[model samples]
Target: MLTCAFLLIVQQAGNASANTRNGRFIVTITNNDQPAHASLPGPDTLAPPREATFAEGRLAAAQTGAHSYVSPADSAVRQQIEELGSANTRKRVAEQDPPQSIVDTCRNDPRADGGKGHVFHRLWWCQEHGFTARATDTNGNLLGEASVNYVAIAWGSYTSRDILVELQKTTLGKPTGVFSDPDAVRFIIGANCADTGTGNGCAVHYPTVNKTLTEWGNDQEWHNWLITSDESKSTSPDLVLRHRWNLSASVEVPGGTGGPFPSPTPYHLIRCDSATYFAGRPKACINDEVLPYITYEINSAPAISVHDVAVHIREAQDTPDLTFPPSPTPKRIPGKYIYENPKDNGLRRIPEADEGPNRAVVRQACDQLRPIPSDEQCDEYPFASTMEGAASPDWDFSAKAVNGRENTRAGGYLRWYVFWDRMLYRDMDSYYVNIID
Candidate 1:
């Protein structure tokens, strides 16, 4: 059961693709309420090598649908939105169906990126979708959040099983050795526009309108153990006490020079914070648009540190049969549905899931049997804290100048996205190592 989770490249578009053992897989989304779908655009639209049937799961998205852009009643944009789903929608004719190698519980099987917990979904989706996405809402208004598959594993496995076996025999088996590889990180990048805010008229389903960024780059929220693993010391039991800011990170603005003033150099998408949404592409931004730029950076450090020290706690409590003993064997068991913490505002959680008022007392969680902590919002383009902090009463993403000036100052902390490659990813590409999430 792969819960729907994601952070996107700067803003939302239709599809985002990521690299994998089999090349790449694309993520398709409909944040605008206008339900949209996609297919590979080569010779014959590549059909999902393995088509897994979705069971009777309740829809987490709103049912509202609309088709317009910038302005709700814009007829021309509305027409363009209408053609999103049905446009170039391709389906393959012939491909052999392969046998699955493993059988995982509903809560775990069919999972391609779950080893990373919830936040990974965001990073994975951002990478996959952004790789080669063409964002155009089915409804121009960008206000139609009907229903959609948050992500689809479109690479080699074809089916979840094919992907899982390789994972089990390799990564899962030797988590210590395999997960350390930097190339292990697999991902892609996409492009599109962003709106202002609620006042700008972005609906609940496709609240994606309003202020938008370019790419949603992320990685596995900081796992204390993963952090220490890279360090020579603290090698026992894979230390799990480190604090990790799930999506907290630094960004590398593609084609960026030194500041955010000149606009993303390439201006991936015209962003205007004045007229509620974008102010609709100003001539200044259009000409100054560069590739990617550091638009937002998480202000928090992604590492967890203990504020106090503790002595031995009665040799720790007895544990369950959590390990596989000393035998070379595989384990299997039944499980339940995974849910989001009632307190979580992310769609990654369910409608009927648990909820509470206080952030601390309200444990954001899922119903899954495994006590997996989900960093659901990490890796969303720009950044979640950045989003929650975007239009705060104190700060404003719309501020033309951080200090009331026209152009941003030099050495300014221009926000940007950090496209993450997971610990298990098989690619060892170079990186800027901007932030430490």
Candidate 2:
């Protein structure tokens, strides 16, 4: 899933039709509430594509007959409506649904540069409302009533450590009967990031304000909020741990009729450390990002051409027909290096004198070419630092007789590439070696 998601981002990064260089937040409100009456049309009456339904029997008691203004049945229904509304609001606020694809949301976002290589973030949340009101005639006669349901959603899009929050509402139902109260119901949607004792601090640029649900059948426009934090100053910040942070979005009804819904039960909407952000945007964190990789140019590092040649030949065409010199295989050589102590099995960082188990294998492959010069050494493909080294039992590797000094220089370059690329341990990460002439 992480690999596919990252690949999607890479693909989107190349699309030319993207309109904005900054991310955007889209919020929507949906109403599925309906009047409580057997004679009234049901959800099937709604236009095509809407699958929502009202709480069938939730307001049945009120529909039987209207009672005194302070009747127990009326009060119970109101309380039930409030409870359901709060619970639904909590569930929606805790959930997340990205408005668009990753790169489209990030690169096109206003916060991110209209170019590649910058980090962007996005989050989505929804809040539900179960509303009820007493139905009465102009002469104060009792009449059947219904409990109405509504949903509000908030989407937060950000880039380079800044958060942009936006809220929207959609009406799924139209209330027809006259209700006692006609005032608009207001809601508040916002976000927060708690300190985990880490020096990294977070702040909201402005306070989130309450927007009205506006009458019975009306729609709500998007509201906005912003949060900002420090970005790493390093040129290559993928491996640097500048600030560790987690952000949670929220939705609430001010008068306690709805909710103070926080993040989901155990998850934050989004969490990003500099490493995962710059390396590649993960679903939400470092653990979920695609594996790291390194690219080596054979032309630039000519001293290691022998090592490249070995790999090229190893992955070369198995049989040659009309071709004079067989062409190297088009497929890339994929392998991973291991540096962890226990997992290396004495193969990593093989010594110059003994060559360890790696030397024994390489000697068997290159013994025929030896005795040429003392300055030369037997070189092996998939270096001793890799799990697919000459000593590895699971994989077949190649060995070639090459200049010893040049081989040593190649080894130094490999070390620098590993450190600079932040390659992780075997299994945790895998990389492809793209041999470019």
Candidate 3:
């Protein structure tokens, strides 16, 4: 049985439109709330899209009636009528009937509770980009109204679906094949790392390079295989990774007497750090190493090329407040050889020597190094480890060393520290072989 759930009456702001010339009224009836005169069967026994009726009256009369029910005050009734004027004179009208589609979609066809007296009656009016629904009482009194815009809903759904699909693919362990093509790697890095005036916001990055990097890095299947042989590590750790590796593969080696570019094809590195764990196990240890290969041509002087590598070692420090020694180091790793300029804080320093293979060229370059004036705070570049908490501290480094050089030239020396984490083995080999060949 079609039941009235609610009733709604809307006042037309202007003359009624042609379609609503008879005036518009919305009345909701449910089998559970059947009026005394209603002879409809229970919701479960009646098929839906059935028509139902409701009793409606002037707003003032309804109010007066409700008050009279509470208290039979003759004087109060007269005062209300005098203030509200003649109820019969009010031009109360019903909303046009709801379209058949709304009736079919929202009407309770059969009692969801199997005739337990609970049934829903909903009426909707389709609009341009969306639709609106209203619930009304038996008297055609407005109960509530809800409006939904389909365009916004669809957009939200598409965005959510895209993210979910990408996330699933990432979790499934897809191969990036970045190592196979140096040019492709370079292009990706350039596209992502270029200064596009967007201030390196994550939202801006999500649709471009960051999305790809995240998908590639989150390949759980690939990580599982990458760490399968390690007895201590059962799965790839959840790394705080980013794309900050820079290479000199595109530029002429500073020294080397013009032999060849150190790297053959231009490629970038994916920098990552141990910051989180899974199943109560530490994901990755902070034992990775960074190396910088620099070539300098001083005033037409013979070009000098130097390669240096460094590993971060946690040192124990004594403190007065703690029973055990506290590591004096702040949660954020500081640049190793690099120091924030106390003066302008605009400049940085790199070693001038050209001979050592494991020399200190830039200190803690991949650490949480910030730009000068401190207020301009170093662009954490892509992600900020502090936001995730000290317990999960990590930084992913990319192999775009040329970007580091560019950063240095731009006076973002602290930001340039990411170059320290370059993947010398894989990327450097490509750097040398591609150029030499």
Error of 1 at 266 (Å): 30
Q: For model 1, what is the alpha-carbon lDDT of residue 373?
A: 28
Q: Write the per-residue lDDT of candidate 1 for residues 1-437, one digit (tens) a residue.
A: 43332211122222323312222222232212112323211111111122111110011111111101122223343343233211221111011111122112212433233211211111111111111112112232121111111222211111111110001101111111111222332122211122212122211111111101211122211111011111122222211111111111111222212111101101011111111111221111010011111111222222221101000000110111232121133321111111221112211111111222212111221122223224221111111122122222221111111211211211122211121111110111111111111
Which candidate leads the pack in lDDT?
A: 2
How far in Å is the alpha carbon of 54 misplaced in model 3? 44
Q: Model 3: runs farther than 4 Å from truth?
A: 1-26, 29-362, 365-400, 404-437
Please give each candidate's TM-score. 0.16, 0.35, 0.14
Tens-place lDDT digits, model 3, residues 195-247: 11222211111222212323334433200001001112212223222221111
Best by TM-score: 2
Give candidate 2 misplaced runs (Cα > 4 Å).
Answer: 1-247, 253-288, 301-355, 371-377, 402-406, 421-430
Backbone atom clashes (below 3 Å) for every candidate? 78, 14, 54
Residue-by-residue lDDT tens digits, candidate 2, 226-307: 4444444223223222221222222222222243222211112222234342233221122111122233343543534434
Per-residue lDDT, model 3, residue 51, is 16
Task: Tell me the lDDT of model 1 at 426.
Answer: 11
lDDT of each: 0.17, 0.33, 0.20
- Ranking according to TM-score, highest score first: 2, 1, 3
Candidate 3 lDDT trough over 10 residues, lowest sum: 152-161
